[model samples]
Target: MLGQAVALLCLLAGDAGGLAFANAEPAWREKERLLENNKTLPCAASGTCSLGHTRQWTGDIYPLQGLRDCLRARVYRREIILVSENRLVAGFQLYDNMMQMGYDHIVLMSTEENCKRALRAWPQVSCIWSSQVFAATPKYMLDRHAFLPRAARLGVNVLCLDSDSMFLSDIYSHLKAPPLRDMALMALKDPAIGWLNSAVVYVQNARPDGPSVYVLNEVIDRLERWAEAREYMLGRNRKDFCWEQMAMSDILMSAVIGRPIAYGCWNWDRNVTYRDAWEGAHKRYFGYNETGGIGSWHFLKETKVPWPKSLAEHAPGFRRTEGVTHQQVIQIPNTQGVWPEEFGGPLYAPVRGNKSRAWMELIKSDGMPLWADPEDPAQAAANAANRELFTYLPEWIGIAYGQDGTSGYWNPALYRGANGTGTSPYALAHFYRLFGAPMNKLTVKMANNMWNWELSHLLHPRGGVFFASTEHAPIPDVLVYSPEVENREWVSHEEWDKATKALTRLAMEMGRTVVYPAPRCNLTWLGGERNNHLPLEIPMQFKHQCIPYSPSGKGFNDNRCMLGGYLMQGCMAARWYFAGGMFPPEYDHLVVHIRDKAAEHPVATVAAEQLARSWDSEELAKTLMAQHGGLGAGLFHPKIAEKLGAAAVPAVPAAAQKPRVLIIPSVLQLTDKVGPREQLYRDHEREDFNVMSCPWIQNKPFV
Candidate 1:
């Protein structure tokens, strides 16, 4: 067979090296055991196994000296709960609750040495860390699949949970009870997205030595394929680990085996099913009004009852909250410095406010899509037809006020218990879908809950860049990209390279991390060239230059690109790319004077021009003074970093690094504190009047 034996003995436990997974199998031993049965392995026999040959991307933030200062992973029992190493305070809160429930064997992934700082700050809860922290890549996040195959081989069940998951009753009883306990692979049936949601998955490995192990191995095998495919297309891997859910859903016979039973109330304003289901139930229970009301969710085997219809089973069930501030949301000492004592819960997203909360019974089934990404018709519509009802009902858990991180709420009762209602509701709520699914800042007056503010984990806790249309003031942010060309002028995303390289170095050297914006929006590039889809990087970052925000919502490229109303959450530095975006005053600091201030020597400039024209990328690689370079003739160039000391950037001068482009990005954001927009506005109005009045243009063309 062309395929060789794979090796993922990559145990990230805090053991021999300090970042080792405690009690986990070592690399050499793991390799030996896995290979012992390699030829007969289920995945291998099926020809789907690729873990050994496929490369896993360890992302931007992955440090070399990791785990040197980390804590050891602790496993105590057969059942293990999994959570990725969260960077926020809510993560700590979730783990604390898990421990209090008297459960050990909780596994943590993406654990960096800095986690020691966070670990010491909270109660000591020993959990196994599968991998050190890495960002924007899946290797660390997908440690679930990496660990699951091992767990199945070892005969153990795994309950993977997100840090945002809320647990009220003990997690063990609810999941391991009657209907769900027996399933081989019971993924969170989110009928909303697909057949399964990996957020709250339960893998049954009781008979791991048999057919059940096949399912576990399948997930691992599929993930390897997905990773390989994504890497090939995007030239990099995405850390979202969305492929996990897709693979879980694709298990074919699994959903029939273990259908999900959804409990907690998801986003009321955002999801259509949650909205429709919630609205129907709320109205029947307490006479439909602006504010929602409470309801019961007792088992209806003919669970023909969808959502609030579950409320019908219990008559005369008027609920009450007996004046006790829910324990589940006791405010903790502020960790992110932005949180108020009033806020509490998994995320310190405020749970209490002037308006009381409400609930509705929701069912989990892979029926159809409950919600989807906003469409052009929906976004540009004059009325809120196919949109999230964010503001109409303040009772839908205190609708978000603005993007300033205020006006936030969470219902403690819904996630935990009904607190004097009929049957206890959801034991836990995975808060992956937040209050505002798409918090559109473009239309702020009617903006849905974008969770730009308040939601600590979603929005950047520390100040950073946020892109949107102007009419404000702020510190500052940066965007590096070129506008679509109008004429058949030559184009290159590589042209934008010099600016990004120089700026990235400056930012990182300043102790600022170059963090890419969240969910990077796609942009139009190499336009008018076969309408070519040229891109600097995939998941194109943040539009057109001449008509940036045209009414059609596509700018100047007809209906090619859509960009705006997005948040940037990196406390340190932001790596934003866009097509001549108008993201100036909104962010505080605008990028000015991008052109090289240092005058280049004529000899270096002449030499660079010749080098730029050279076809050999190998030669370019050798001269790649800052970031990109592969190999070849320019290798013996003089080292500039040696002579220039502190200020010098690798030894290359700007003129040498840049091509002989006609125009350079001298200024990034046009709007600034200097306030030139007012003058420009007057100039445009005057020009418009002149164009309208000039009757000469109306006459037939006179050659």
Candidate 2:
């Protein structure tokens, strides 16, 4: 009975200890030993290593060569070690992500009892856990205990990580031991204390002095002190002492013998800001918010974190205007923010003289250069007109163009001469019509069909072959043109050839149009023969009406900058009158010129205008149909005219019978350029009136 009782008591004690091991600190000793080994030894082969005072060989074993391939190709370590109680799910997820990142060795440490239970539950994730480890140590106790039985493991390093950490991207490439300090420490920045989070730590055993054995010891000692301090403060006796935090504060304040820990912004986000300041031509502001928005703030009291300056607060002659600069930040309202009151509506300007002074030129007054004339009165007026007209256009038109990636050539001028007209026929034909003008039929030919070098040509000085920087650069005896256009130089034949080949290759790769030597072509009122060689030479008086269409050769790169320039210039001109409609590459200029001729020859012009209108009218019809029918109209299908109201009398031909018109709702009208929606409804009276809505402008009917 005594022997049996003794045996039963021993079994019971073992079971109780097993339960404790399974509960907590099962992997503690193993983790501790590995930490110590990594801090002391080096890698013998690649994956296998030793820990603490014992050398042990621990790695994943595979029987097949193919299976080993997975281990080697993935750059995985032989094995990994981990500690947990009931965190198997977390453990496996962490293991998989890390394994893909190249760490292979997996060592799971739990209480012996839990280990048995967990292994039975999850056989795929093979792990080893022994209850031999009872507490946390500076070194891995499991590794240490296993070292004596197995001698193959030695000089191996270990990397320890907490379960909460996540890898954003592959960090192995940037991973390296930081510069070693004698007594290095990481500090976290807190409300009361500025320091680092000690959750994740890097341990390098590259010290020639046989590793820092006292490093972990010191940390453990500090941890003990921290716990003791916490317990003492929370005691029921209410001893005369500061809080646990106060103890930490005391330790930090006593900079007597311990080395200070260095902490910085690396591997973490830091809240840092600056004050607005300026020097010379430079301004500096760095104010930002937690949500990534930038702004300025004035605090009654200083914040715990350093505040940064606003990006726009500093300037050379900065003035704080209340309405303009709100909260010390310049509000640039984009798609998300509330747009300022001045954002939308018809831009109105005082009307200038109706007609050009010189009959030969369209305008007598000098105008501002393109793109840099938002403030110029004439430019502003033109732009305002363009915006107003833009509203009436059906949204589908823009959508269609966007889908088709509207095609056109961009042009640049190469040579400028005294007689040189800065425009091209193709440009005149396309650009003018887009602005609601009649198109002119005039074909443009290239000087060299071999290349499309329009941008460089436009930058070239006086219609000459010489480079801007060279001595041979053309000098106009009477005048020097604008420096921006004059600064471009003519490239040599070799350079041109190389450029052409390169451009061709690029175009082929990107599948875009290949255009070269783009001349500003304005074909309006100019005949094909008249504008054929418009940019070939610059003698302003060289108007040989019968210039050949094929100047150099046939089947060459003919799309010149003239075509592009003409289109753009036409768009600019269109801005003056018409509000809606995109510049069409196929028939815009043709329609405009035909409309112009319609005045002289009403029959032909009317026919051309009808066709032009038809094209846009078709798009308008499709847009309305989609709005009503929830589908796009077929391009080839005949348009079904729906009359919402009576058509107005034709102002041009009294006998011409007007067609029925479909009226667009006033609400939809303001959707594109809305302003003060409530005010708009309040201003316009509700009445039974018909609105003439063709796909084109108010009077212009689409075909």
- Using all chains and alpha carbons, the TM-scores for the candidates as numbered come to 0.33, 0.22
lDDT string, candidate 2, 62-128, tens digits = 2123223322332123233332323443344444433333233444434445445544443323344
lDDT of each: 0.29, 0.23
TM-score of 1: 0.33
Which parts of model 2 are misplaced by more than 4 Å?
A: 1-86, 109-114, 124-156, 177-194, 206-213, 222-703
Assess the local accuracy of residue 263 in candidate 2 as a C-alpha lDDT between 0 and 100: 11
Residue 15 miss distance in model 1 (angstroms): 22
Model 1 poorest ten-residue lDDT run: 323-332
* Candidate 1 ranges beyond 4 A from true positions: 1-77, 86-90, 100-104, 131-137, 225-242, 252-410, 413-424, 435-703
How displaced is residue 687 in candidate 2, in Å? 63
Tens-place lDDT per residue, model 1, 1-703, is 0011211222212123123345765455655544454444323322322223221222211122221112122333355566765543445445544433334345455454535544443213333344422222465455555455445444456676665554433445433433344445544444243233566656654443333343444454434433334434233212213355555443322211221111121122456654556455534433444534222111101122122222223212213221110001001011222322121112111231111110000100212122211122332222122211000000111112221111111121111122323322223444343221212122121111111122221223232223321112111222222232211122333333223333233222221222112111223342333222111122213221110111112212331222222221111212211111222222112222213432320101113233323222222322332322111111111332243344432233332332211111231211112112122222333333322221111121111
